[model samples]
Target: MLELDEKFFSRFGAEYSPNEIIFCEYEPGYEFYFIQKGRVRIVKIINDMEKTIDVLGPGDVFGEMAILEEQPRSATAIAMDSVRVLKFHRDNFDALLQGNPQLAYKLLLIFSKRIYDAKRRLMILLLEEPNVKVMDVLIMLAEQNQQFDFESEITLNTTVRQVASWAGMAESEAQKELTHLARLDKIELYEDRIVVKNIRDFQRIVASRRKNLYSS
Candidate 1:
């Protein structure tokens, strides 16, 4: 890793709320990477629809692709949770390329990983059935935690607009689904977080919509 000045990160550019977009107008800027905590979803507006390009969690990085290419940002990045990210200006990249070959190589690796994950997400999005896709999202979250406390609730800080972008659905459809699920006692809204109430019930929904990938 290249030497980074911690003091330089005092402000961290800008802060964001869950589902709050960081770059809406898509102007020229520096590349940024979240070194602290939380999740971020990179999105793009296409055909008047907000489409999620990728989901980035802690230790994950983004925004360098545009800076490297000397192009405008291809998409918007929204905070999936309250987040702090370190930004690297174009000058910083220029310096690294000129003075630190190792750092330059590291940036390449990060870009590769981002591309790989984006491909996987695109394939998953192609699957038919909204129910199945939604179930997959829940299962993915469950696996992220790797816990099975039926009594405990797992809350996600996301909105219908954000979930719709992630699931390739209309915002209204996503809202309807969420409302239906909540009415059926499958989930509950606890403040800003969406809580999965009955874990077993949610699992059954996932199992019912399970595809071949769920098999051993």
Candidate 2:
């Protein structure tokens, strides 16, 4: 929920239609963007296939790492739907940081959290059991979809292929694990979406799996 102000729109506002490519992997980038509306997906090429790493919505920032490090883009960003974004060039971004200390501090916090999440996902990938890995991914997705209501089910707007990619397993294997969970009344999977029964129960399942992992 970035406040869309008059000055902001006049300076850096731009709109992208659904399925548009915002940036491609390995391309040189000089600007970062903040989503003012809609959603975007961050994807990386793995084994010659595109794997979605994340989905970002309004108020989220992307391409900052390239701007900060002066490096080529690490992943491709594409619009998930009609999107409005405010772009900031590297020099302009530096100027804003110097003038707005609070903005700089907020960006620092966001970057740190992203780094920590990446590390945790890496650790999850190291787990030996496919079921454990899948459960960890589902729990992560559930947490991300959680808002203020802890009692409500979280709906994951994602595909089985993407979940399989995140879990480091084949699509069939992921499907089997998901079916098993459904049979146990743990989750409900639709064509391209999943409904997590409850976040607390999801966490309990993950904790139970971790215990089993260590005990065995």
Candidate 3:
């Protein structure tokens, strides 16, 4: 990310209230935004249901993919709280990039990272079995969600249904798999959270399961 000065944000920033829609998927995107304050949720519609792809915070830039790819918006951005963003339009987008070498470089890195993250998450969705997908989703979140104080154990604020949504499987299927994992002492499940006993152990389990899935 570029070290954007306060002046750059203050000059072009707009405020958004909590739960406000920054942009919607499939809409004609003519501009992009840089988050100056608060958080934003990146959501995609899957099977007529909204699935949150990611939650982005300050210093992050979004909606640029639409402008860069010259396609309709692929996901919707919603304000998670009181938010401030520096909105940039396409008209002078090139000139802005040409003038700011650092910003251009940062955007390129963001593109690369987003693509890799998308492919990584797709791994769970591509799996054949719900049990395998559930385990894969847990592994994915353990790696991706930085809030976890990683060590011997790490807990996450999530539900089985949320994991199912990410895995693109039924909530019942996710619940059944999660119970099985819990019984195996792989994870500690609660009404609102899950505690992964060890990330490496979880990875090993998922990898073995994935291999068997492919072999069979």
Candidate 4:
């Protein structure tokens, strides 16, 4: 987890919860550092269709763009579950970043990582898994949440719509794949998590999808 200094937390506004819309497309809001105990969804709507672009969890931070540039949001941020966040206004964030060089560097690094993840998403969209992009999203989630010393059970707290948006697939299709995976004994659903039964199987599916894209 990215540790925030006392100064940052002290100056932050109140915490928020699940299902709350933090920001809307083209709207302005304070920069937020969400320590997601559950899940959060980043959405972008285009041409009248809603697309979920990212599913975030613990240690994830967003809303930096608004504070950095004093510009409107390019997308919408919604809490997918009961969540905790540290919010800072643009002025406070600017002061913090300017005074603490290391903190600024860390924030920049986080930004770079998000850019990298976005590039990976573009690759998945352009080069592979035309129909199974949701699987790719699951694979990414598995990588992030996989248990150590056990090849089984990656715990994820996300919804079908969120996964579908990340994968650029329809929600029904994403649901179908989740069911199929459960039937295949690759994963199992719990009350609050999707337990990955076989990480290798999911990885193999993602690899095969990538290969198909490369060869096509």
Query: Which candidate do you rate higher for lDDT, 1 or 2?
Result: 2
Tens digit per residue, CA lDDT, model 4, 1-216: 646666666666345577788778888666656563667788888668867777788867777776658678888988888876677667677676777667577677888988888887776676454445766676676656436433655667777766766777776877787888778777775545677766677667778777876787
Cα lDDT for residue 61, candidate 1: 65
Pairs in steric clash, model 3: none
Q: lDDT tens string, model 1, 1-216?
A: 334466645744456677777765367756656445678887778888667767877656677765657667777888889976766666666764676576577778887866765664564476566755554555445544646465576776656665666677777886777777788777774445577766666666555545444552
Top-scoring candidate (TM-score) = 3
Error of 3 at 85 (Å): 0.9
Q: Between candidates 1 and 4, which one is better according to lDDT?
A: 4
Q: Give the total clashing residue pairs for model 4.
A: 0
Residue-level lDDT of model 2, residues 10-91, one tens digit each, is 8889888999999999999988988989999999998887888889998888998866687899999999999999888888
lDDT of each residue in 1-216, candidate 3, tens digit only: 456677876766788999999999989998888887899999988878788878999889999875666888989999999998888888868877887788788788888988877898787777777777787888787777777655668787789878988887778888999999899998999999998888777677678877887898
After superposing candidate 2 on the true structure, give the runs of residues whose Cα lies further than 4 Å from its correct spot.
143-159, 183-189, 192-216
**CA lDDT, candidate 4, residue 50:** 68
For model 1, which pairs clash? none
- Cα-based RMSD of the predictions, in order? 6.8, 3.8, 3.2, 5.2
* Candidate with more favorable, higher lDDT: 3 or 4: 3
Look at candidate 2 and tell me the lDDT of residue 73.
Answer: 92
Show model 3 residue runs off by greater than 4 Å: 1-11, 46-48, 145-157, 198-201, 212-216
TM-score of each candidate structure, all chains considered together: 0.54, 0.73, 0.80, 0.62
